[model samples]
Target: MSSEDFPAAVPIPVLATQPVVLASGSQTRLSLLRGAGLEVVAHRPGVDEEEVKLSCKAGGLTVEETAEALAELKASRVAAKVPAAYVIGADQMLECEGRWFDKPEDRAGAAEQLRALSGRTHRLVTTAVLFHNNSRVWHQTDQAKLTMRTLSDDFIERYLDAAGDAVLTSVGGYQLEALGAQLFTRVAGDHFTILGLPLLPLLGFLRVRGVLPS
Candidate 1:
């Protein structure tokens, strides 16, 4: 988005007693944090997400439980090293009916994902976990249900061409904040939850912990 699209700036916090570190390399999540006026440092965690998903499946973990587990894993990994920082880890899962969807790996995968999601409602299960002093201090999960309007094959092809590789960035092959909004007929829940973070609650936790003004 252009600078004109952003909301007016809030006064950024200058006296956070502990540093905030994000345990993921997602630019979207980073923008969410920075946009909220939190000074953040981001690190891509060593997480083998596919393996984690498989384990969760085999262990009979539900969608929400699995997402929280992944978030905690990420936060704890980063927290272990930065014991003094407020390390944040987040994860998102997309479940349509009983099926789980993941980030599409290629253009063909993107097209396939969109086809499966057409005219269907899916739940974006987003979770965030916070750790400080080498302990998990807080975590939250929020779900956003989005219904994709029936999409024509031609339109999907055109969208893939127009959107290019950007569609592969998120689960369900869409980013609601961008061209992907065209794919949805209805969206219910907090905007940030769909973006893959339970951002407001995370901020609330920080405020309660004195990381931000209450």
Candidate 2:
């Protein structure tokens, strides 16, 4: 929410000479950026994700490619408005046994998704794209594998009730950083990538572009 210009009393210095903008409203991604010492402004890119996903699927694009396409699409939309800044767009997809999952539309959907993912190994595909001057400059795709413990119907209901509406924020109705951890028996991937942002890779790209210290 705050800009890069911190008061002199603060020790933190502005990291980016080129302005940075995040073309997504994800609080997780925002925290990841700010926590890494990059002052960033977040914007809603307003891209129709379902449409993009459907189009990509129809066109025979793999889930990884679809993730990148969705990420770049969001970044490009925002970059068009703020051509001078590095606009970051990101997206995450959840897949299990060839089925793709989207964020739950309601409590019932959340329960349903949980049931489907129960006792299974699923992959989370995350993509991050950077655009400047309305053109794609950088992008990366990363994935994490998670295996959920076999959940009983009663347990699923209780988990859904406990997670509340917050479960609807991410695909697969789980947030690995929070109560969702109980749902998993095993996880393999970068912690940040599981949260739906490739923070390390994105930071590496920013450093290479001279927007961050070497």
Candidate 3:
């Protein structure tokens, strides 16, 4: 059969099984929802991620807590937009020691990030919150610890040359699932968690909410 004539695969199960709204402007999050067979409409929350992180840091919240709060904020914002639909909001933070890392603004910033994370185990805390009818029905946080191998200045430069602006997209200077995989010596956590969703738990929540077939 020609590619166009091939039947579509069955969609992944989701709670409600009905269409839902996803808050935030992340393509990664959108792809994750699509992979799970959910009909998701994307809504970008107009919050400044950096500002939220700074406020959370000033308030002395842990990285994990900050991530969840931001997720909730995004969900709340979008939930207001579509009051009758189920909404999902997600946020991620990278922390080393007590320091919070923001998304690098440029290649130089990414290089600096790589240098700071070198030879250290950093935690990536990803949080997701579900809102329905303007109420938070469920939430979860997935935390992953990744240790980056120390690289020489030459290697860092080469990596930056190869990865370019892609490095600035995530909180850390690398995308573990791509070419950035070469930068890590050890990683401990669920693959989905590293990707910033905690898929299984989120799926479980969806199933319990009747959004996915039981």
Assess the local accuracy of residue 171 in candidate 2 as a C-alpha lDDT between 0 and 100: 94
Q: Which window of ten consecutive residues has the lowest lDDT sum in model 2?
A: 4-13
Question: Between the candidate structures 2 and 3, which one is better when assessed by lDDT?
Answer: 2
Taking all chains together, each candidate's TM-score versus the true structure is 0.92, 0.92, 0.92
Candidate 1 global TM-score: 0.92
- Please state the error at residue 62 of candidate 2 in Å: 0.6
Please write out the lDDT profile of model 2 over residues 100-146, one tens digit for every residue.
99999999999999999999999999999999887898889999999
Worst 10 residues of 1 by lDDT: 10-19
lDDT of each: 0.91, 0.91, 0.88
lDDT of 1 by residue, 123-159 (tens): 9999999999999889998998999999999999999
Model 3: residues with Cα > 4 Å off, grouped in runs: 1-16
- Write down the worst ten-residue block by lDDT for model 3: 8-17
lDDT of 2: 0.91
Candidate 2 has a TM-score of 0.92
